[model samples]
Target: MKIGLYFGTFNPIHVGHLTIANHLAEHSDLDQVWFIVTPQSPFKKKSTLLDDHQRLEMVYRATKDYVKLRPSDIEFGLKQPNYTIDTLTYLFEKFPEHEFALIMGEDNLKSFHKWKNYELILENHSIYVYPRLSKGNVETQFSNHPKIFNISAPIMELSSTFIRKEIKAGRNVRPMLSDNVWHYIDEMNFYR
Candidate 1:
C-alpha cells in the first residue's frame, strides 16, 4: 500500500488538517494517509504542545470516521527531537512491504533544504505538498523535481497555533475543529 505520512505534533488535530489529508487520500494515488503524531519535532518548541497521548487522542477522534485517514503514534517511541530523515529511515525498515511518501505544506518545502539529510529523503520518498499561505520561495531544485508532487489541495490558513491562542483567550473556535476534538479539548480544559 502507498501511505502518505502526514507528520505533525497535531496539538489539537483540527478540521483543516482533516480536509487536506482526506483530499490527498481520495484524490492522489495514496491508499491511506497516516497522521504520524510527533512527540517532539526538531523545528518546533515543545512548550506549546499538549501531552503526546492527549494530542493522539484528538487525532484518533478526528480521524475515526474517515476510512482513508488513520492516526499513528510511531514517533512517540522514537528518539527525542526527531528528524524527518531518521523517521523515514526507520519506517522504511519497519514496513518494507508498504511504500511511504511524505505529505507536507508548501511552507515546509521552502525550508526543506535545511532539514537533516533532505537530499537523501528526496532520493528515496515522494513528497506530496499542499498549498499553504507562507512567505519565501521554493528552491529551484525542488521546483520541477520528479519525485515531488505539488497537489492542488485547498490552501488551509487555519493553524494549530491560532486555535490555541483563541482557546486561551476564551474564544470558541469550535468551527475550526471537529466536534469530537472540540469536546475532547473542552473536557480536558486544554490550552485554557
Candidate 2:
C-alpha cells in the first residue's frame, strides 16, 4: 500500500484537514492518506492542546466517513519530542510492505532542510507538498527534487489556533469542523 502521512497536532480535527487529506488521496497516486496525530512535546507545554487520545479521537471522528482517509495514533507510542524522521523509520520497520510518503504544506517545505536527517528522508520517501500562503521562499535544493512533489491541492487557510480561539470566545465555529468532531468538542466543553 502507498500511504501518505499527514502529520499534525489536530487539537480538534477540522474541515480543512479533511479536505486536504481527501484531495491527496483522490488526486494523487497514494492509495490512502493517514492523519498521523502528533503527540504533544513535553518540553513546549501548551495548556490549550488536548491530550493525545482526545486529539486522536477528534481525528478518528473527522475521518471515519472517508474511505481513503484514516486516523493514526502511531506517534503516541513513540518517545516524546519525536521527529518526522524517527516516525518514518519506525513506520517502515513496522510495515515493511507499505510505502510511506509525507504530506505537508509549502510553509513546511521552506524549512524541510532543517529537519533531522532530512537527506535520508528525501532519499527514502516522497514528499507531497500543498500550497500555503507562507512568507518565505522554499530552499532552492528542493525546487526540482524528484522526491519532492508539489501537489496543486487546495490551500487551507483555516488553523487549529483560530478554531480554538473562536470556540473560547463563544463563537459558533461549527461549520469549520466536521460534524462528529464538533459534537465531541462541544460535549467535552473544550476550549470554552
Candidate 3:
C-alpha cells in the first residue's frame, strides 16, 4: 500500500488539515495518509507547542472516523529533536512493505536545504509538495531530483497558528476546527 506521511504539530486539528488529507487520499496514489503528530519539531520554537499527549489526542479525535486518514504517534517514541529525516528513516525500517512518501507544504520546500540530511531524503523518497503562500516562500526545482514530485494540494488560510491565536483570545474556533475536534478541544480546554 502507498502511504503519505503528513507531519505537523497540529496544535488543534482543523477542517483545513482534514481537507488536505482527504484530497491526497482520494486524488493521489496514496491508500492512506497518516498525520504524524510531532511532539517537538527541531525547527520550530518550543514555546509555541501544546502538551505532547494533548496534541496527539486532538489529532486522534480529529481523524477518528476517516478511513483513509489516520493519526500516528511514531515520533512520540523517538528521541527529542524530532527531525523529518530521522523519522522517515525509522519509518522505512519499521514499515518496509508500505511505499512511503513525504507530504509537505511549499512553505517547507523552501527551507528543505536547512533540514538534517535533506539530500538523503530527496534522494530516496518521493516527496509530494502542496502549494502554499506564506511570505517569502519561493518555488524551487524538485523535478531535477529523481525522487521528488511536486503536487498542488488544496491550500488554506487556516493554520494551527491562526487557530491557537483565536483560542487564546477566547474567540470561537468552531469554524476553524472540525465539529468533533472542536468538541474535544472544548472539553479538554486544549490551547487554553
Best by lDDT: 1
lDDT digits (tens) for residues 3-79 of candidate 2: 99999889878899899999999999999999999886443465667988999999999988899999999998898
lDDT of each: 0.93, 0.90, 0.84
TM-score of each: 0.97, 0.95, 0.93
- Which residue pairs in candidate 3 have backbone atoms (N, alpha carbon, C) closer than 3 angstroms, thus clashing? none
Off by over 4 Å in 2: 41-46, 136-139
For residues 74-153, what per-residue lDDT tens digits would candidate 1 score against the true structure?
88888998998988889999999999999999888887989899989999999999988766665556989999999999
Q: Give the Å shift of residue 49 in candidate 1.
A: 1.2
Q: Which of the two, 2 or 3, has more TM-score?
A: 2
Per-residue error (Å), model 1, residue 141: 2.6
Model 1 clashes, total count: 0
Rate residue 86 of model 3 by lDDT.
Answer: 89
Model 2 vs. true fold: TM: 0.95
- Ten contiguous residues with the weakest lDDT in model 3: 136-145
